[model samples]
Target: MSALLVRHEANRLGRDIAVGDIHGHFTRLRAALDRARFDPAVDRLFSVGDLVDRGPESEQVLDWLALPWFHAVRGNHEDIAIRYAKGNPVDQTSYIANGGAWFVTQPLARRPVYAEAFARLPLAREIETPAGPVGIVHADSPVRDWSRLVWSLRLWRAARDRAMWSRDRLQGENADGVAGLRALVVGHTPVEDPVVLGNVHHIDTGGWMQDGRFTLLDLATLQAIPPMG
Candidate 1:
């Protein structure tokens, strides 16, 4: 992955817009946004994570996600990078089998940029909306009681730990989804179609697999914008 220069501050908005796992499909992402009439100049876009790896254009995806108009949480692939960055013993076999080698093979000059970008991404985002609060993460969050979990430190820490370890138990309908929050948006388990599980939305539609289409979910309306391709 290449280094993405953060030219501006993070986007903080009361409005709603959320995107699913990009996985390096820049052309498709642009086309989807165009179809949806997304205006980065005004509206905000949130990513579910896994912005890189297992794709032909990881560098471009990194650069695109780094744009000021978008925000993303850390995914399992990112956790692998963090471990690699820290010289921690990673599961080399699984990491490479899962496409970590591509990222490791990138030019050294670009590694720092990716590392910095990864370091800056928040584990979870709290969006204050008229309806209520929306929580965004790469996978399932630890908020057992969605209503009480809004902006809670305990929930954040649990979600952060699950993200970092790539724990499978944290992927699906672990604890019956969010209770009180308006919605919990996440991307990790690639689905043939984007799924709305209770208050949770699974937006990773396997762009790396069969027709190579990525789905972007509109947070406010819960609409799935299929890949433009």
Candidate 2:
């Protein structure tokens, strides 16, 4: 087992922004960033993962994996994508049923590269911000203990099951914050509005839904943009 935690060096620009489940909505994400006057040189985007699937630009978002300013956690969608790419018939069925039709339509030769990218994504990230250390996990952090969570992340199976898929942590959020971090940001579950349960925040506004839009949070000010039309 290897450590799955990635430590993002503290950003002093007070311009770190977090965006909820992208789900392949790159254009919308860019619009949100433009509206927010995002400066990639200083500001960093901590994506709550799900960078692909469920939208027209799913494949396009994969092209951004190499950009330095973007950071992401392993979301359940990514987990599904990876499993399906590895020749898991059951996972293939699940992925295709869950908005992965476009993925299945792609050439099989291109699938391995995508799988390699997903495999490299960190399951969780802890960043030192102007406020304090902010933790980012795709869905929920099943373990309340930071040390234990790190331990669990080292094992690929545990990280995939708990960090990427579990929603149990939502029930534990409160003003006290989870794992003693200043804040915990998550996105597997969608919410109409960004809501904070204790110190845990769910920012996924369902960008893939017909009536929904992506939510981008300016962590420095704790303010998020209203969903677009």
Candidate 3:
């Protein structure tokens, strides 16, 4: 498998935290980061994607992503937004119905900018840290042809095609429930609670839903910050 070895210099004494879907709730996101003692100047922040849509502050979230310390993978929402920006035929009705109205309400100038940003997000990223390797993506794969699956442009095209599914369906069979060298980290289907099934972990806690909470996972210790409130 071809993977980029993403290396970052360790801070004097800082933790590398990977967070799940933000979904535009900047307030709660900020609070969670603060509670986790995340120092943007030193500690690194990686997001599993879905940084926009379904909540207030979508613009603010995009602005925050432009920061150097923050890295992210492209989520399905981002895929739809890019298609919309390019004037491609998208499920506008479904998108708007599902909090996509926020993007439409954005200033025209900002729309293109955020769309470009979303388009630039990586499909998958390999974080090579002192501890181990972590692979970040919006979802996992269950196709037993794992090697072929990762190399297939078709799989990525399908994911970017804006197909909608329930949380369970989205989880598929590889829903962070297996163990391997490449630990999978993802945030697509929001969960009532973060799940740790093997070497993979699902951190999307649905901060946009009622009684929802944002979560950050420390890569080095493999610990979930805030202890699941």
Output the number of the TM-score-best candidate. Answer: 2
Please report, in order, the local distance difference test score of every candidate based on alpha carbons. Answer: 0.67, 0.79, 0.69
- Best-to-worst ranking by lDDT: 2, 3, 1
- Runs of candidate 1 with Cα error greater than 4 angstroms are 1-15, 146-159, 164-175, 225-229
What would the TM-score be for candidate 3 when compared with the true structure? 0.81
On lDDT, the candidate that comes out on top is 2
Q: Pairing residues by index, what is the TM-score of model 1?
A: 0.79
Question: Per-candidate TM vs. native?
Answer: 0.79, 0.90, 0.81
Pitting candidate 2 against candidate 3, the one with the higher lDDT is 2
lDDT of 3 by residue, 71-163 (tens): 887778887888888888988789998779988777778788888888777666666666666666676533222334344534455543322
Worst 10 residues of 2 by lDDT: 168-177
**For candidate 2, lDDT tens digit of each residue in 72-117?**
8878887777778888764556677678988788799988878778
Candidate 3 wrongly placed segments (more than 4 Å): 1-13, 142-150, 153-156, 159-180, 227-229
Of the two candidates 1 and 2, the one with more favorable TM-score, higher being better, is 2
